[model samples]
Target: MTKTQARKLPGYIFLSLTALASVFPLYFMVVSATNTSRDVLNSRLLPGTALFENFSKLVAQQDVASAMWYSSLNAVGTTVLALIVCSIAGYGFEVFHSRGKDRLMAFLLLAMMIPFAATMIPLFQMFADFGLVNSSVAVILPAVATPFLVLLFRQSARSFPHEIVEAARLDGLGELSIFFRIFLPTMRSTLAAAAVITFMTAWNNFLWPKVILVNNSYQTMPMLISNLRAGYVTDYGVLMLAVLLASLPTMVLFLVLQRAFAEGITGAIK
Candidate 1:
């Protein structure tokens, strides 16, 4: 073979292996979901006829519909609030760099460095004082302003053209109007990326939710999965089905928003 052809062969092999590795778990999950518990434990590789039975058991054991609705509400609420608050904070810190604002920004960044575990007790106490324990608001409030998102938005905002802001100001637009109209529209891709990240984070968050949300009624998919796994006689088929259901939202979000997400990253990096 030619030298160039030989070099390309390794790349092709590596790509194929990586693709297989990524897809293998999904394939296994599907197989497990279709098998009975005994078959799943036996590591049966083929799809079986037990999928409907397992799904029925899953639905009966957990209030699957209610859990799904609650999870969706929590995830969506947290994502929307976090996106708006963090993006605005990021934009503000970048565009309005007064000494006070800069100092506040530094403090916010420092807050991010403190471990979430360290602050859990204090945060819990504060929530208790406000009588917000076990509430969806408890989950949404704490995460509305994520430090990483603030930093990301700040970086992306640096690419915004100052000339556009000046032009908007010359047109006698209010600051809020300028932000909502000019800045937001121009940063659509950046916001889209942030939305995907924030939504995924909220959807997958386990620890804080586990701590704050006590009742089964308020439980998220992660909590449900944890409880299911902790059962004495675990059904791997049912567990796999639950996992697949839990993962659907983030997968859907990525599929829908991937183009904008990629453009945002590329634009920010450029």
Candidate 2:
């Protein structure tokens, strides 16, 4: 190899090893999911024929369907609402300049630094006062908009063309119309990234949902998975199946939106 190739070889090997390390657990989970609980105790990598049986058992033991439904609802709802709210707020922050606007955005960033655990009681109380405890709304409402997401949108919106907004205004398009028509379409990649992020966050959220969703029927997938692990005699096969089921959507979501997400982030970086 040339000097440059020789120098880069270690880096490439390190990256390859890191990637394999990252992927192995997921591969093991899938392999385990397809095997019997007893068979999973072995370290073999091959998939077995017990996949459906494990899943069937998981469904029988827990309200997997209801958990999935609630989780999906929370994820989708959060993604949609966050995109709508964050995009608008981002656009406004970037496009509308006034006194203290920068300070307000900075304050919002500071708000993100406050740990979620610190505000959980107050947030729960707010929901409880509204009679929304044990409801999906409680799970969805708190994270419908977040400071980090708002910052993401605002930063991404900085790359948006300002001249178009001015032209739209000149053509008598209202601010909202211009935003919906011009900004939303232009920011598809950013929106996709945010959507994936929000959906994943909601789908995988354990803390707030665990605290708020009191009723068994409304418990989310993460809670269900936790239950599987909580028992003293844990079934590895069943747990793997639950994990796979819980993981599939986020994987699918990333696969679908990865291109847009990449473009959005790279665009912002530029």
Clash number by candidate, in order: 0, 0
Question: Pick by TM-score: which candidate is best?
Answer: 2
> In model 2, which residue pairs have backbone atoms overlapping below 3 Å?
none
Residue-level lDDT tens digits of model 2 in 1-270: 899999999999999999999999999998999998888887769999998899889989999888888999999998899889988898888899666889998898889889999999999999999999998888888887788778888888888889999999999999999999888898888888888889999999999999998777788889999999888899999999999999999999999999998987776666
Q: Write the per-residue lDDT of candidate 1 for residues 93-165, one digit (tens) a residue.
A: 8888689977887888899889889989899999999999999999888889888888878888899987888
- Number of residue pairs clashing in candidate 2, backbone atoms closer than 3 angstroms, sequence gap of 3 or more or interchain: 0
TM per candidate: 0.95, 0.95
Q: Flag clash pairs in model 1.
A: none
TM-score of 1: 0.95
Q: What is the lDDT of residue 238 in candidate 2?
A: 94
The CA lDDT of each predicted structure is 0.88, 0.89
Give the top-scoring candidate (lDDT). Answer: 2
